[model samples]
Every structure is written in structure tokens, then in C-alpha cells.
Target: MPVNVYRNESLVQMETYEAEPARVDELVEQVRAKWSLLREHGYAGDYPIEVLRGNRNGGNIKVVEVFRWKSVQDRINAQTDPDYVALAGQISSLTTAEGTKETYTQAVRGFNHNFPSVGGVELLKGVCSCLLTIDGVVKDYQMSVKNGIVLMHRSPRMDLDGDGRNEMYLKILMHGGEIIQAALGPIRVEQNFNRPNDGIVKSNSAGGSDFPGTAIWRVSWKIHTPMGPVLTDPDQPLIFGPATVNHYPPVGTHFHSPTGPVALVHEETGARVGTLTPGELTAFDIVVTKDDEIYADVLNTPPADIFEVMEEWRNRMGDQEVQPVVAGATDGVM
Candidate 1:
């Protein structure tokens, strides 16, 4: 029957019924009497501690405190009485002093902040530059503000180097911890990405609505297919960007394809030459030649089909090689 109560919810009280300690029961009584004192004068935090139990034990009083916002530890420490020791010896005569322990477990909870808008631009720029341009992490990721505009770029950190950091993001918050916005982009990259990428550049057409450049610059895009160093077909697409030769994202150009997803390089020296797997052939097995000079794809390619239809773009360098890189097995159909 001895219990402290709080009506706001279930209850956060020091339960003694489950314990065995006569001295503690008495301490409970003395604690109740003391709490009654704090309650009468109204201490602080506008919250009052309610004493629901009062009994004799170990020559002391057993008690518990009830309140809102005030923590359980506060109540336990509040147990201060000069009379406890003398009273404890007296209570032990009636019942043997047993054992009890103070056990505690704390909890933590939280949520995410809204995406930043204005200052976020600069924040995102910094994040991308630090992660990508600075060369920290090895993985690459794209960064852009989403009021619905592609505004930033952050390449993977690890892909750029042998270093072991990931291109990550950080949220900017006020002194009070209220998050104001986000800073996102690549960081810690070992290599500089100078590949021709214009889809990510924002701009209008050369003759269309001019934004800021003397000529039309660029805009972001989602390339529908994969790209290669070259396509056998003269009709294949090239990098889609402002053409010193022409302007616009034409369908059959390298620029017209998606941004670099995979990397290609010389097999021996580990030098990157912008070679890539033709889209749809990611699973083909690879074998490095004994000379350590070139990577010989282990997977087999399709049999020569002089009679079978050949895609002009793929046959050259677009995707499918006219001769099989692997033997007679056609894998990763696209």
C-alpha cells in the first residue's frame, strides 16, 4: 500500500514493496515528513512533490516523491535526514535489516530538422567542395538544394583516392540547437574530377532565354543509357553540353549519356582513361592478364553475328564490341 503517485501518466516512483529492508521502511517515513515540509513552502519549478507513503523502518521513515518534470534521481537524493542512523538501530530490533539497491536507466529521444533553403546553398557548396574538391572520402554523391533545383556537386571521396572517408553531410544548427539548414557535398577526394560534365551545369539554350553567360551554358539531366570512351558508330552521342561545335543535349552523344557511374583505366599502371562498361554489362567477369598490362575481361561475349542485327552505336564503342571481349557467352543483356 506504500506508494508515491503522479497523475500526469503511469508513475515514476521509488517502489519499496519489492525490496527487503526494515530500515528503508522507516527511512521512508522520515522522507515523507521532510517532503511535506518542501510542499508546504513550495520550493521551485512550480512542481510539487507528493508523498503518498509514510511508514516506520530502521528507526527511519520510508517514503517516495511524486512530481512532473523533476527527475527520479532528484527525489532519491532529496532523502536527507540526520535522524536516520540512530532511528535505523531502533527499527532493526523489531525486524532484521535486509537488502535493497538503487537501480536506474535513462532514456533519449529526438527527430530530424527541415531542409535549409538560402544559407543552405553556401553550406551545400562547402560540403561538396570539401568532400569532393578537397579529397577526403572515397565515395561520390550528388548534392543539390531541393526547392526543386539542382544546385551542387560532390563526388565520392573514396573513388578519388585510396583514403578511407565517405562523402557525407552535416546539418548546421543555431546556438540553441535549432537546425537552420544543411551543408552537403563530396569531401576528401584524392583526385580532381575534370571529366566533361554539362548535364549538371544550369543554363538555357544559346538562342533561348539567356540567364548569365555570353552564350548558353548547361543544365542537369538523367542520362537514359551508359557511356563509353567511344562508339564505333559515328552517329553515337557525345558529351551533352554547350557545343563550341553546337548547343543542346542531342540523343547520340557521350555528354548526352548519364554522368560517370563506373570507372575505366589502363590495366597495368592503374591510370584512368575514362573507359567504362557499356550500360547493361556490369556483371561480366574480369581477368587481369599475366603481363599486368591490361585487364582481360573473363566473361565471354556473344558469337560474331555477321547475319545478326548489330547496333551501330554499340558495335563501334557505344556498348557492344563487334568482337567479343569474353568468349562466346553473352551476359548482362542490358
Candidate 2:
């Protein structure tokens, strides 16, 4: 058995199965029945199975079944067991052809943060997003964050499609608060094609601006199914930073704690950027926010860094000195 571990935790093994559209339902039933038998035969740990319908292609429906086991040894033993063998044989008979299986281990960081608690059902509750392009039109669908949970899997870098380059899986929260997972590739088109002429052109001349232009690579999101790139929904908005008022300036952004908002400010000028809402912010924004607050406060003045402003507010609130009143005559005398 091949087992891979990261930082002392054994990676969870995932097995994916694809089958013809007509036989997917039947195959799922068969797998569940086999699972029941495996439990009776002393399969004690929690094992989750998901059935997803891939976009239809060439009259074939792609069905994906994912299985997450506690350990690679457990997976190997279960597959080689007599009962499992019989079940596999029965499942193969119903498929149009032999389904493919791939094994994957979960990253320790991703697993610990996402599925920290018991129960496999928690995996489906995390926020997810789906980006799809159909007929040359691209759109993004965001799933709402529920119970403060985000991402079924932390951005695990892996070669999910067996391509030479690695891809990152992003879980987007859908409009109905459901999960729609998508894969993002990091490699640029020019690099992937290996053609120097195909790459993006760079300019070295300074354009007299404080912020110089730099090349940034962006990846298009694709639906995580065997079916060849089908659009899921076109109406949903792309998942970005905190939701802000439509007319709000995009200069500054805010950070949030359990108590309330923490305004992000400029490092040198200490000018307020924008305010963040009550949810998770983007990775890029988080980095910027941390970088801005690394310096100490000069004085308790206007345009101070957010932390300094907060500290000043707390100090004023704690100081409670009574003001002296002028002496006055008794009753109506002034």
C-alpha cells in the first residue's frame, strides 16, 4: 500500500469512479449496498460517498463517486477483501465499460481546518463556487457562507486531471448556499504551450506612475467533471472580496474580528481604505492588511493606523474624570 504523510498526519485516500449516465443510479445503489455489507464486516470508521452528475457529453453522462477513507492501508484491505471483490464485480457488470479509479490523499492543513470535527456530512457544508464557460461566455456562481464554514478542501495543490502541471481546487458558495467546486490551474498558456511567441509581452519603460505595471497571471475556472466544460449557471456573481455598497470607493478595505470591524489603513499615510463586512476576506486583501499594520503609531492623531485608533478609543473610554461645576447660590440664586 502506498501511503503519503504530511507533517505527521496520514493523508486521507480518495477513490473516484465514473460510469455511464444510464447506469449511474444503479451503480450508486450497488455501492451503497456494498458499503452496508462492509460495515457489518467490521468497517468501523467514517467513510463518505458522493454521487455527482457531470455535464452530458456525447450522450454519455459522467457520474463521479468519491470515497474518503481514514488510511491507505484500510483502503487496500477493504478493496482486496472477498466481499468487496464480489461487490466490485457486480458493479462492473452494470457499467458500459470499466470505470476508472484514482487515489488522492488530503493535505494535512486542508483536512485539519475544513473537517476538524466528526461526521462526513460536514464536508458538504463548506462554502463553494463554480465558474463555467459555455459557448464562449464565462460566468461565476458563488455559494453563500453557512455556519461560518468555508472551503470543503483548503486550496490543495495537486494534479487532479493528471496534467503535467498542478491545479488548485476552490470551493465556491453557491447562490442557494450550496457548494459548487471548481479547479484553477496556475500555469500560463505560453508556458504550457512552450512557445516563446505565445507568451504575454512585457514593457520595461516607467509610465510616470507611482504604481508600476506588473504582469499578473489569471486562470479561468472550469467545472470539476469529466464532461468537457459545460456551463452550470450564468446568473450567479463571481466570488470576490467582502460585499460592499455599490458606490463605495475601492481604496481601503476593512478587517473583522469577533467584536466588530477593523478598518484597513495605508502604511505611510494611515488613510482609511474601505470597510470589510462580516465574513472572510480574500487572500490578497489579507496580505495587504497585515503588511499595513506592521509599524508603530507616531501619535494619537487623525489618519492613524487602525490599531492605534482602536487603542486610543479604548484609553478614552477607560478614563472617567468628573468635571468641576461652578459654585452656585441655593435655590433660584445665580
Stretches off by above 4 angstroms in model 2 are 1-13, 108-334
Cα RMSD of predicted structure 2: 23.1
Candidate 1 on 18-59: residue-level lDDT in tens?
223545555556545544543443321234455554545544
Q: How do all models score by TM-score?
A: 0.16, 0.30
Candidate number achieving the greatest TM-score relative to the actual structure = 2
lDDT of the structure predicted as candidate 2: 0.32
